[model samples]
Target: MAKTIHIALVGNPNSGKSSLFNVLTGLNQKVGNFPGVTVDKKVGSCQLADGLNATIIDLPGTYSLYPRREDEWVAYRVLMQQDKEVVEPEMVVLIADASNLKRNLLFASQIIDLKIPVVVGLTMMDIARHKGIQIDVAELERELGVPVIPINPRKNKGIQPLKKAIEQTALELYKAPVRDFINNEALAPAAIGSVKELFPELSDYKAIHYLINHESFALHGHLQEKIESIEQVNNFNHTKTQAEEILQRYQRIGSILKQSVSEPSPLKKTLFTEKLDNIFLHRRWGYIILLAVLFLLFQSVFWLAEYPMNIIDWGFGEISSWLGNVLPSGWFADLLINGIWAGLGGILVFIPQIMILFGLVTILEDTGYMARISFLTDKLMRKVGLNGKSVMPMISGFACAVPAIMSARNIENKKERLLTILVTPLMSCSARLPVYTILIGLVIPKTMFAGFLGLQGLVMMGLYLLGPIMSMFVSYIARFFINIKEKSFFILELPVYRAPRWKNVLITMVNKAKIFVFDAGKVIMVISLILWALSTYGPKEKMRSVAARYEQQIKQHPEQEAELNRLKNTELLQNSYAGLLGRSIEPVIQPLGYDWKIGIALITSFAAREVFVGTMATLYSVEGGDDADENTLMEKMNAAVRPDGTKVYSLATGISLMIFYAFAMQCMSTLAIVKRETRTWKWALIQLVYMTGLAYIMSLIAYQLLK
Candidate 1:
């Protein structure tokens, strides 16, 4: 409490930085936005053994001091404390991967030159050992002039020592054990002198950094003017200086590694990762394995969640029936039991499937197989005018399109990045799951194929793939129209495989479920109440006429009173606000086999694709009347019929609806994000028109052919 120690965790991509941060801070982490950037500011606080608290900022994973991407700039800025959103760190915790020490040591050496006290948290020691690499931690520490504590955050080992190192280093003002990694006096000493003269109170390393990055640094007005003058006066060449410094640093790093680390003959043995990659990354089997993995994922989403979903459906139905019987018969009671609760129940029943999807995804990411997925799909990406990096946004699109589109910023190629953003919405996100689940249940027969794969699951997986498949096709066409000649680059590091960290997986599942319940659940509830109100009320004159007509017919034909009642219910719905709204759009969607009720759901679901289930639940429950019936949403939808007595959800209509959702940009958030990411309504508006037109054409064809 007395001293707020700020520790910044820095490392290259796939260096176990995230795992270490998660272990160090646990649930104390909070995500916020950094100043002047979209990059997330991840800060967490942990209590040390001596009751001291440390705030650790997990800066973006970057390779070196020189910034290239926005994320790298974010990391660079925070380390320099040039931004208001970041605190000046008391210590820098460099997460060096032991298996890839040569490259990691390069970045660590750069930070040490920054002269901000540094402690290296060495990770992946086990993987290093497996690869027949031995590291003398104490010797490496002596050479780097910092504490190189070997820790496995995934296994919860050596974390206390990491914290202790952080605490002790903070007390000593991050004094490095070895001080100078390279003789800065020889490398760009003249440029350093020019910088140090202007900013008299800077370290040798800091002065050189200023000389290299002076144009981009936070210096302003007269100070900036002086730096520019100094640059011109000294003819400070950034490229030449950078290359020279790298050469010198590596020369010394080579000597340090030769003394402190030993590696077995590479020809001696094969690694477990190599054995696994043989199948997973094979030219032919790799693609087959990828498809199988995807098939299983979607298949399990249906099969595994089936029992839990049925229980939730049945439980909600019982509660609705019980409430209908117990509460006094009134409009308020009807709304309470049917409108709000039923709508909510529809969304909640989908939690199991959502949890399963995120859980499985977390496992893939933990095991480092996600990178392979990107790698495998790179060739396909190139066919669409994108490269391997584009796969990340497309993969993230399976969760939600907004963040997925934001993630497109990682692709440095402007043309490829824009195309990625434009098509990312084609990936069927979790928002579309509700629509998929209900329709799959209604139309896809619960039959097994090849003994293990269920027919319904196959349908589900096909629907999921529909979006991305269409996206690639769409991009192939769009590339010719929007011409931006830019080179595509993709350099990926395949991380060493490790066991799935169950705690992280569980945390991801729980967080995703909570987001669905608390965030999406709120939207569903509001729309449900509004739909209930519209369906329950009508124009005063029209309502009175319909009611009087129905009453007279029922009295005149007592023997056919049940038919009259059904007609009366139908008439009331026709005159109601919701019904009229649906009727207005019915003609357009009717060709796709949707009736007025389905039309209403289609309209409301533009707010969110998942709202279709909630809208269906409320509207159907309202039409079923104030009776105690234990019918699930699927059952009620199945029993629904038109005025002429035809079924509402025919196989053609169900398939058409799924096809429509798979292509349509029905999510407002996605559009907003598109506009934000592109920095204009021009691109987002074009995307909306393109996607909607495609959806309409596809759905029309599907219905026409199936019907």
Candidate 2:
């Protein structure tokens, strides 16, 4: 029987660790939460030579053994074997960026102390050569006492050898005494003495972790007596004093590099990196470029999706029409065609937009310009009480809020992370785009605003822009109240620009698009079906009586029969289950200028914003009449009159509805994710109450003022 070997890939942030993992594992990966924390655990399996297999766990990137954030803490925990459920790796593959060896070596040395089988995979060797840096691979391997393989993961080079080294090392077929920490001679005696006195059984790395103030040491109850003994020997605080000692170790590593590493020439600054950064990161031009890029992105989503959207629309219509003709014209037939089909149609029509947006984002991220954008925006973000870390998640909100909130885990500060999560949903996600597009199309004239800008497009742009403005306002206010004083710094690695790997981008695009279509599709479909049943089969006596009364009039005046049947169907719908439900809530929404039909759509739309269009389609389709066009729906909505003869869906009502969606907590998945991330219901509740209240007040003002 072949044993399953475990390998851990460790590296610093932006070291191409994830890209390497993707190359190695491909589709043989699964992402799960670390035992108890929200930190993600990515594990995959790969088949090695000789029919052997290995499970590779990609640990979160950390600069040192000392962890500052929860995700990094999970990494430390896994490596230390502090948790019973977490397994220690048989071998550790330490990935280092060749161009930035000084910073990358800091972690490499820490891993060497762990006594695990280790191999060094030097990434970004191409960039290093471009910058006139050269490494003697044989000398590096000898100096590190382990195999050092130079790799360009992006180009898929040096992968096979790296895999073979891992497999060979895991089988204990190779062993070498790696170079140990050199400059910590003064602290070694004290470190060993404390280990012997306090944690006699602990590994050297675990002892080092205790010396460096890792909290897991304290969590080990078995070490309490030893810790007390060590404390008595040293009057100094172990964590703080030892951290200073660790800094000396880093200095020693620097000395080793100075002696072993040589630069072929004075480090030459590349004009390419500098020139690109000059324009893309310019203070004034950067913002302009960002806005232009965003505008183009949105424009592409709208203009490009039209063809596919039309195809999907026509397909759904055909399916509904066919169902209507074949089914027995009863509740079941109505449910299949109008309810389920319409609801699903509303969800599926947005697939093209989602794919295009995600593909663009993936390209930006893979090319590494996203990091520069984060760096460029950091100063501005700090002024509003956020950091560079908040930008990606905030930008991600434009695509979807659930993942945006989940991405906040990268933020280390609890308060800052919470604030980011709280306000992220307020950013208009793609779900709201459908609502805004439809409403703006109806209310805003297509003519230019001030004879230069497209008014409708500008209004849509304004709605998108409103979200960040509101998020910043909320974050600023929260910052003032929260008493956090930790000094935050932004340290981002701007990777060398390279052609985006289209394969990776396409895979990401497909995954994200699939998630949206399937996850959101199921909810909309079920709701639509339920709604169809309600609309098709009401109180039988009421519908039968209404139809009979209309039939009598039709028999008396044959020419009026068509008009009378239309009236009878409308009346039946008003008395149906869905209609009764809508009527019950009419009084509450009357101030917003919505009638029973709009009320029904609003109720169904709580499941998803795009469902509103589907609800309208289903209600109209069940009437056994001609399919309503965009113009027809708008005209019917505009001409709807309340008991007092006031028009429903007027300019005031449309604007109010749009504003309502702009700030409302309309997404349940977003709420559920918030709850999962915060690990409490309190924050999610706060989001729900505040966002709903804000939406209600804003909508009320718009309706009242416009009225």
Candidate number achieving the greatest lDDT relative to the actual structure: 1
Candidate 2 lDDT, 430-469, residue by residue in tens: 7787678667876777887677889887888789888999
Residues forming the 10-long window of minimal summed lDDT in candidate 1:
622-631
Please give the lDDT score for candidate 1: 0.80
Task: Give all TM-scores, in the order shown.
Answer: 0.80, 0.86
True lDDT of residue 279, candidate 2: 89
Give the lDDT of residue 304 in candidate 2: 72
* Regions more than 4 Å wrong, model 2: 83-85, 176-179, 183-201, 211-214, 217-229, 239-241, 264-269, 303-352, 396-414, 429-461, 478-487, 511-578, 616-628, 672-682
Per residue, candidate 1 scores C-alpha lDDT tens digits across 662-706 of 999887656756765666779989999999899899999999998
lDDT of each: 0.80, 0.74
Candidate 1 global TM-score? 0.80
